[model samples]
Target: MGFFSHTEKLPGNWPSRFHHKCTSKKCTYPNSPQAAEGRYVCLGKVNGSPCKGTYEVSPSDAKAAAGWISREVEREAEQSKKLMAHLQEARRRKDDEHLQLYQNELATYKRVLQADAEGDIRFIRQYIRDIDSVALFEPERWHTHLIHLREEVLRLQRLVRELQLKTMNT
Candidate 1:
């Protein structure tokens, strides 16, 4: 888990500044002679954890830094692939669950609407029977109440029909 530390390039393979600490707090000299001698610093973690460990390498020692960088890149790539696959599986499972929930809700709605429509029909039938009885035995008793009852029956019938239409469309 190593990477090349960001450094400003100076002339002849020298870095402008070293991430290493200096003894003097107000030291103006950033590029020490030892640090400037083709040294490449790895400002990366020692393991997966952020240790901030710095590994210094000379230009002549390419094998050390190259091996660390290559291995880290390979490991990260494999980890990313596994994570991507896991995410895709989770998304697919969630989608299936959501679809099942939607279907269950639709079925519940249909059952409720059908029950309501049947109840309305029963009420309309009872009202018709009452109206027939009144017309036959007490025609003089017919008033605004009878008209309102008739309108209510018609309204119930319309409501049931609308429910039926909605069910069919869905």
Candidate 2:
């Protein structure tokens, strides 16, 4: 599998910056001051143990970043799902030809997303093209939307966690 490298975005004094040794679980790293020069110790292993990694942030900072990315991904997934639902409904209404064309376009867009080293936000909007082509029509059920949204949100959260870990080590 291909790996996603985040070296460019990560800071140098990682592990220690976000997580410190759990000397007292009750008193978390809240009282700890911000890192300087990317120097943070790794609390995951031994106390005051220096680690090497990049993309480090304070615990709170990491939380904020994760939340931001999660929200964005969730929104994207929900939009994609809405488009898919529209295509489905259109097909049911004897618009199979148009809907099939959208499916093809969606597949191509997914490929573009995978291949691009840096994602083009402009093309992201084209997902709307897929829906518009089919004259998008779908029952906007809150539960279904939430279900799809959760998938992308969790995936983005994982990515945030991985980036945090990376910062801690470098």
**Which one wins on lDDT?**
1
Candidate 2 local lDDT, 33-129, one digit each (tens): 3333233443332255432322234455556545655676799999999999988666455444444454554455445444333655455335434
lDDT of 1 by residue, 12-117 (tens): 4434222232222232223222312243333334345433333443543345545545676799999999999998778666655654554554554444344445
| Model 1 residue 21 distance off true place after TM-score fit, in angstroms | 11
Instruction: Count steric clashes of candidate 2.
Output: 14
What TM-score would every model get versus the actual structure? 0.39, 0.24
